[model samples]
Target: MAVPAPSAPAATASFTNAGPAGFWQRAAAWSLDAALVAPFAGWLAWPWIAAPAQAWLDQVRALLQHTGQTMGAAIIDGASLPRLAITLLHDPALHQATAAIRSATWAMVWPALLACALLGAIYHVAGECSPWQASPGKRLLGLHAADRRGRRLGTGRALARYSAGALSWATLNLGHLMATAAPEHLALHDRCSDTRVRAARTGLPRWARAWLVLLAIAGLVASAWLAQAAGTVMQAALERALFWPG
Candidate 1:
């Protein structure tokens, strides 16, 4: 009887030739991720933000009261735009008001901004390093981050990629725009980190397209509502300031 031939081990598959993701795809994914992360970041930063925000509001009210008293009810009630502008420009209190507003605004904003940045960094780094090789937003869009060999990124490489993304922002986003023209569709951070965002599919799925459309509609509606509400509030504040008892 003849001896059976030994079988060879199966070779592992290399990276697919799905190509690099388009700029719009990457942008959409980032936007989605930002939306998902913003609420949590805001919640975490609220404790630090609330006091400064309240202080800023108080300063604004005081400034308005001072302005009303200085300009007097006559000029304000008449709604003389030029006179109002001239008075505001020459008022010494305006300088102090402006300074206080700037200081309070910065104090209220910085903590929230820092929280968002830190949380975003952690989210991106961990997601890219995971077995899925993509953040939830990227995965939803059928995109993944990988090395040249199509291997998933390590934690260090993912972190490096996330950090280098700051360069893209610092460049006024010209670094990010490079993806549109680059032969391989690689952005500055992608090149700096030796990584790529690959599209697992040719185009967006129907569900993603629908979701984007709905999101756009919702955003438009929210913006319109906010603008109307803001206008109403400003009108009310102006009326109160002009008519308030001395």
Candidate 2:
């Protein structure tokens, strides 16, 4: 009789929890990741957004030219050009045009979305394959992502895990909430990818975690401030084009 080769190990029906992280800890880790990733994603999207911004500025110029032509017609008709121009400055058309240009700028959302995905891949995929088996946020929160057997995931598996994470987001976070419902406390992505985020045997010191949290908050504040400044500049430029058209 020929000797038979051993069969592959059978898959388990349910994973042991092993002190898996609950929803709140995972949410906190995700929040920290968002804060850390936003600036980098914004930087990556700047070049793509610049084109849309410029197009919007051009549209503003075109609208202003149209308004100027209307004012010129009123002057030629001897229709009290100064009064007509003053009224045109507050015309509903100008307000609508401004809104449309802003909408055009907002249309660069696709590139920004791609930048966000890439940043998440760099943070989660690469980090999970590393010796720590966790991203910075996860590490700070004392969580380690690993395969069912508690082994660090290879790069391919890590990428799969990252891609699955999109489903969690796309489903309005119901997939994420699965972690709270699942017996193993695994998110949809984790369950599908055969991974789990268990409490690490050891984590960063308390002082280090505190500093990281502070930095994340600071980054969020800085990003918000920069966005406000950019919006102000754009609004001012639009106003000049509308009222002081060349």
- Number of the top-ranking candidate, with lDDT as the measure: 1
Query: Candidate 2, residues 1-246: lDDT per residue as tens digits?
Result: 997754322121122333677776777677777779988998989899888877877776656555655565555556785778677778887778878787876876777888999988988888788777778887778777889887778999999999999899899999998988745788889977998888743234566457668877988999999777655655555555556655
Each candidate: what lDDT? 0.80, 0.74
The runs of at least 3 residues in candidate 2 whose Cα sits more than 4 Å from the true structure, single-residue gaps closed, are 1-18, 51-106, 201-246
* Tens-digit lDDT string for candidate 1 (119-157): 998999889887778899997887889898788788899
**For this target, which candidate reaches the highest TM-score against the unseen true structure?**
1
Query: Per-prediction TM-score, please?
Result: 0.75, 0.57
Candidate 2, residue 52: lDDT: 83
